[model samples]
Target: MTLLALELLIMAAPDCKGNSVRGACGYGEFGRDINDGEVSGVSSRLWKNGAGCGACYQVRCKIPPHCNEEGVYVVATDYGEGDGTDFIFSPKAYGRMARPGPEFQLYSFGVVDVEYQRVPCRYGGYNLVYKIHEKSYNPHYLAVLILYVGGVNDILAVEFWQEDCKGVETHEKSVWSGS
Candidate 1:
């Protein structure tokens, strides 16, 4: 389902143009080139406490003549609270949503009215990847970030289980807490 059906003002972050600088999602350098640098930072409502990290969305500006109908398909690689905005797209993603000759015009507007919807991510034949956080030091602690999660489902929580002398009982704990 579309997270926000109503049109809202969204802008492109000047600093987020190149090398997907780390954001709240902690994807680090790897997020830089994801989807060919066509990525976006979503608001808290859509961020869903990191569950929206790898979610994909189809976003298009509503500006006539300056906007293209196809819109850009972007992955939520980061999170940030915008000023009355739902997304802050990278330069590439923002320009991709504009018509051929009016890209500069669209950029001049800075903030444009937009509508976005949650969509399935496409990564060809690649499966979901789990990247162990660099800070993890094995038995001491483990932190994993899921990448390329293709579906629209939210990863509300992650659980780790172990088989012990407790007669195959399950031990459950939340790896990351939303609260």
Candidate 2:
């Protein structure tokens, strides 16, 4: 049987295991400190395919009077159970999805049913962002972390070249974040 509305009970992001980082696609450290508009996995099959790495989904709810009328747009940043109804949300997201009550009392609902759909999502920017650390000041070499902002985790390399240095151009080696 297919589930139309999310079938299982959901957990607040901070309470979840590791914030669902190494998500379904199994990459990056998507810490719980993420925004409220992030969703989790469904069945094993869905996680392996549809909602894997960079898929987007719109999850709307009406159970909680305090929830938003406009849906929350979330990226599949993590994975949940495979054989059960799953939709793990961040603490703020769940609070918005449930009754306007205390955090400890929200779980009283157990499971909730809401409308959801897969919408076209575009995170316009380099899926990978290079963060030049403050301590990365070296004359002979350079270092950085290829943070995955969006898209697939198929990064092979990061190339860099200086435009001009004393009327001379220089290009340094790229740094890979696969440690």
Candidate 3:
């Protein structure tokens, strides 16, 4: 099986402002509601000074909730505190939240989820290694390589690295697309 690929979604409350205690500036989620079939989970976190709460939550997408196929959701409540603002999700998280299913895997590292958007590419300009996708934040890229290991969930790997071409910074982005 490939390492989990996840997209991150963020939401913030309106009252917070100017970066919260987490030293990050973004939206805040005073309240959250997740509906899965007939089951639901609700939680609340605090945001102060337009700062981020630094809280992360996981939401399962699989019908039975697979251990590997899940997404991480984050909310920065203090983003637009002093200024007029509301909740916002990181580009990486937003992309993941948009799709809820076991069709793909998602993994998160630090504040960024590199596996959010994946595009395919060729290896050594000849062999087909995997797909490549652009990072939501910067012009960089990510790559998702496929492994033929015999299993219900075919093995796949996601890798992130920086690439420089003609003075332009480009990276390879990849994610597992359960095919």
Per-prediction TM-score to the true structure, in the order listed: 0.80, 0.52, 0.21
Top-down lDDT ranking: 1, 2, 3
- Every candidate's lDDT: 0.68, 0.48, 0.27
TM-score of 2: 0.52
Model 2 CA deviation exceeding 4 Å by range: 1-3, 12-22, 31-37, 49-51, 64-66, 98-106, 122-179
Order of all candidates by TM-score, from best down to worst?
A: 1, 2, 3
Model 1 Cα lDDT, one tens digit per residue, 1-179: 44444343344455545234446666666676778888887788887766778788998888878999879998877776666678877888888989998888887877778888888788886656676656566664556666676566666656544542211211111123111
Error of 2 at 157 (Å): 17
Best by TM-score: 1
Tally clashes: model 3. 48
Off by over 4 Å in 1: 1-21, 164-179
lDDT (Cα, tens digit) per residue for candidate 2, span 1-179: 22147654465555543255444433335334334345554555445543243455567664555455555655555556622565665545555554345544555665656667665545556454556533356665555543334643433334555753222221121222211
Q: Return the lDDT, model 3, position 136.
A: 37
lDDT of 3 by residue, 53-143 (tens): 2222344333234223444343322222221222234334333433455223422321223232111221224333232322233444323
Candidate 3's C-alpha lDDT? 0.27
Pairing residues by index, what is the TM-score of model 3? Answer: 0.21
Instruction: Kindly give the stretch of ten consecutive residues in candidate 2 with the minimal lDDT sum.
Output: 170-179
Preferred candidate (TM-score higher): 1 or 2: 1
